[model samples]
Target: MSNDSPKLTPRQQEIFELIQQAIATTGAPPTRAEIANQLGFRSANAAEEHLQALARKGVIELVGGTSRGIRLKAGTLRGLHETRRAPASAGKSRLGSLSGLTAGNLPLPGLEQLVLPLVGRVAAGHPILAQEHIEQSYAVEPSLFTRTPDYLLRVKGMSMRDAGILDGDLLAVARTREARNGQIVVARLGDEVTVKRFQRNAQGVTLLPENPDFEPILVGPDTPDFELEGLAVGLIRKDF
Candidate 1:
């Protein structure tokens, strides 16, 4: 058995599944509170305890203060021998293939791996979709972002040129259904997607453009529904 597949109690297995789902869907590991909620525990501490147990068993790694920071150990795959053998070559296959089967295909060091698709445009505050907006996907480690971002946005306009987020730059975006004050975010207003520095007031939220020439956009307390797709985590520039 692989070291990644260390035996665990049923509770640990449940926690493992929850962490996997959170990482797959959110680009980050689930929080203690989220794990608790999913497992129907009354307190987040309960989930934390279980997670601690998992960490001790070498099945998962954890990064504190980061959402969805749990990384499943590689080499945990249970049935590698069955998948690797071709029927005709089953008898001739090398022992290395059977011995090398792990929980995941990549090495353990790559557990925090995440591949984010570069999107062409965002619907200003709406989620970036691979089918409709993605230009390409780049492999990245989740730790590169302050918060794990769900996708990358390909900037198209110069509204944020002054902020070093130039047109054509790829913006790493952390997906959150909600937004807080003073965060650089990808927002959707109507069908349009825009990147702006976000600020909020009692009156409403303002989407501020980095360039002084561009005016800040004010959203009324109530108006068209807006979406907070994600926060800007990092940027990458391609060479001409």
Candidate 2:
């Protein structure tokens, strides 16, 4: 290690290792919620502060305007990899304890699973996956969904029951600004977030709920409040 490298405290080291392990296993850095959950922190802000410290110490770089934009230094990553390769048994034990994951839980080289943030309610006009909105995160197998979702939004209503989506279900959503007609999407109208089938024409856009009890929402072409957050790619319901 170079003298220029910042000294990491035990907690800082653990957070740094978690970030690296996340990138190694999931192909994406962990969100604040993920780190908090893994570390048993009651609030995600603790993880946020640690990340800021890491940045200040030159251990990790934080990208502005993105939630999971953490970057590990190339030299630090190489050093971490070398540490993992040091002794066969030590490497196994270290890998086994990363955020409580063992080698068996990690995906093979070509098969990377995704760790998606579970977004709760969105504060009006704020980004959907903003730090405050993320409740937690879950890992899903790559082969289990239609497409890779950027995050999971908790379903709130029976608006799409006819389409098998229910209240309290977890909706897997892929990030995209555009949604084709007839596709289910997570959309925003002012402060409200809703799941509905999308349709558009020269006149305007119509958000159609599958349940007849709910009326379709009409947005004129020039409406400034309407925004498409993402497309619904898959669904998950917890038995508990």
Report the number of the highest-TM-score candidate.
Answer: 2
What C-alpha lDDT, on a 0 to 100 scale, does residue 212 get in candidate 2?
A: 77
Give TM per candidate: 0.50, 0.54
* Residue 67, candidate 1: alpha-carbon lDDT: 41
Candidate 1's residue-wise lDDT over 1-240, tens digit each?
333357879898777766644433432356788788888999988988898899898766654534434555433322222323446435321111001112133222634567877787544444468476777777654433335667777777778754445677677777776766656788887777889878888898899886777899998967586777777765555544
Residue 142 CA displacement from its true place in model 2, Å: 1.5
**For model 1, what is the error of residue 97's alpha carbon versus the real structure, in angstroms, after optimal superposition?**
39
Error of 1 at 218 (Å): 0.7
In terms of lDDT, the best-performing candidate is 2
The superposed Cα distance between candidate 1 and the true structure at residue 67, in angstroms, equals 31
